[model samples]
Target: MEFRLIDRIRERTVLARGDVRLGIGDDAALLVPPAGQELAVAIDTLVEGVHFPHGTPPRDIGWKGLAVNLSDLAAMGATPAWALLALTLPRANAACVDGLADGFAQLAQEHAVALVGGDTTRGPFCLSIVVHGFVPPGQALTRAGARAGDAVFVTGTLGGAAGGLRLVQGRLPFDPADEAHRALRARLDRPTPRVRAGLALRGHASACIDVSDGLLADLGHLCAASGVGAQIDPNALPVPSALRGVFGSAAARELALSGGDDYELCFTVPPADVGAMQAALAAVDGKATRIGTIVEGQGVRALGNEPLAAARGGWDHFGL
Candidate 1:
C-alpha cells in the first residue's frame, strides 16, 4: 500500500531538474548547486485544523503546505530548485494521496521546483515540505539589512486570507458565491507566493520578510533583526477590496494589522532607491504599496490615528 501510494505521488509529480543527480526511489536525493550561488532552504509543517480548517480540501492543504515554504524562499530572493515532502496520513487512502499530489505538483511545476525525495507514513494528518533555492552571493535579501529612513513596503494585498478564514468560520457573514468572498477564500486556500516580486527586489530591498504571522508580528521581527524601528501610517495601508467589502473600516483595519496567514512580502528599501525599486517591481506586474518608513526607535510604531496598541497582538502558536 505504501509503495502504491509513493508510486501514485511519483506519477503525479515528476518535476525534472538537471541539478538532481539522483531523485526519488533512492535513500536520499543527490543534488548539485550551481557555482557562485548560495543555497536557500526553508521548511514548514501544517497540521489539520491548526494550520487550516479541519474540512479544508486535501488538495488545498497540500498546496498550502508547500506554498508557505516557497514564500520563505521568495523572501530571500531565491530561485527554487528542489523540494522534499514528508506527508503523514491518518490512513492509506488513495484518493486523498492523489488529490494532494495533484495540488503539490501543480504549484511545483509553476515554480519549476523539482520534488526530489520524501517519505510517507500512517499518522495524524500533517504535511511538511522543505524547499531549496539558489541566490547569487551577496544578493540574497535578509531581515538584518534594514536601516532607519528606509521605506517600508509590502507586496500584493493584505488581510484577505485572515478575512477568508473568518468567513469560513462564520464569524464574517457573506454570500459564499460572492466574487469578493470567493477571491478571499482563494487567497486563504492557495496563496500566491511573491517569487517574481522578491526577485525584482533583489539588490534593491535593504531587508525583506514574508508576512506569515500578520503584518505587525512579522514586521516587528524584521525591525528587531535590523536594529531599527518602523513607523506605519494607518491611512497608507492597502486595504483589500474583499476584506473591506465584508467588514467595516475598524474591523478591516484590525484584520490588516494583526491577521495571520497573508503570505505577502514585507520589505524595506533605502529612500534614494525606492523609486527605481517600485518601477522594477511594477514592470513585473507586482503590486507594491508603501505603508510606512523605518525610524530611529526600538519597535514598530503607528504614526496616524491608530494607536500603537492596534497592531500589538498577532498570531502566536502558544498564545491563547
Candidate 2:
C-alpha cells in the first residue's frame, strides 16, 4: 500500500529537469547542481495536530508542507529546483494520497521544482519535506549581513493568517458570506512563498529571512545575528484592512507584529540601496514596505522607545 501511494505521487509529480541525472525510481537521487551556484537546502516537518488542525483538507496539508520549506529557500534568495517528500499516514487512503499529490504537484510545477525522491510509512499523520534551491555564489542572503542604519522591510501584508487560524479554531466568528473572513482563512491555508521577491533581493538585500515566526521575533533574530537593533514604526505595518475589520485595529496590529505563518520575507538593505531594491521587487510583482531602521543598539522595539514585551513572541515549538 505504501509503495502504491508512492507510485501515485511519482506519477503526479514527475517534472523533467536536466540537472536530475537520476530521479524517483532509484535507490537515491543523482542531482547535478548548476555550475558556480551555491545550493541552498531546507527541510521542515509538519505533524498533524501541531502544524495544522485536525480535519484540514489533505490537499492543503500537502501545499503547506512544501510551502513552508520553500519559504526557507526563499529567505536565502534561491531558485527552487528539487524536493523530497516523506509522508506518514495513519491509513492508506487512496483518495487522500491523490489529493495530497495533486496539491503538492501544483505548487511544484509553478516553481519548476521536481520531486526527485521520497519515502512513505504508516504512522501518525505527518509530512517532512526537503527542498533544494540554487543561488549565485557569494550572493545568497543571510541573517548576518545586516548593518546599523540599514532599512528593515517586509514583503506583503501581515496578520491575515492569524485571523484565519482564529476562524478555523472557532475562536473568532466565521460568517460564510463574509469575503474578509474567507480571505483570511485562505491566507492561513495556502501561503504564497516569496520566491520572486527573494530572487529580486539578490545583490540588493543585506540580510533576509522569512516571517514563519512573528515579524518581531524573526527581526530580532536578524538583529542578534548582525549585532544591531531595530525600531519598528507600528503604523507602517501592512496589516490588511480585511484583518482589521475582523479583529479590530489594535488587535490586528498586534497580530501583525506577533502572529506566525505569514510566510512573507523580512529583510534589510542599506538606506542608499532602498530605491533599487524597491524597483527590483516591483518588477517581480512584489509589494515591499519599509517598516523600520536597523540601529547600533541590540533588540527590537516600537518607534515610541518601548521594548516589545517577551510574552508576545513568535511560535516556539516547545512552548518555552
**lDDT of model 1 at position 196:** 90
Instruction: Please identify model 2 stretches exceeding 4 Å from their true place.
Output: 310-316
What is the C-alpha local distance difference test score of candidate 1? 0.87
Best by lDDT: 2
Model 2 lDDT tens row, 106-145:
8999999999998999999999999999998899999999
In model 2, the number of clashes is 0
Stretches > 4 Å off in candidate 1: 304-307, 310-316
TM-score of each: 0.95, 0.97
Candidate 1 residue lDDT tens string, 5-115: 777888899977889999878788899999989999999988887788878887888788889999999999999899988889989988889889989999999999988
What is the lDDT, from 0 to 100, of the residue 251 in candidate 2? 87
Clashing pairs in 2: none
The TM-score that candidate 2 achieves is 0.97
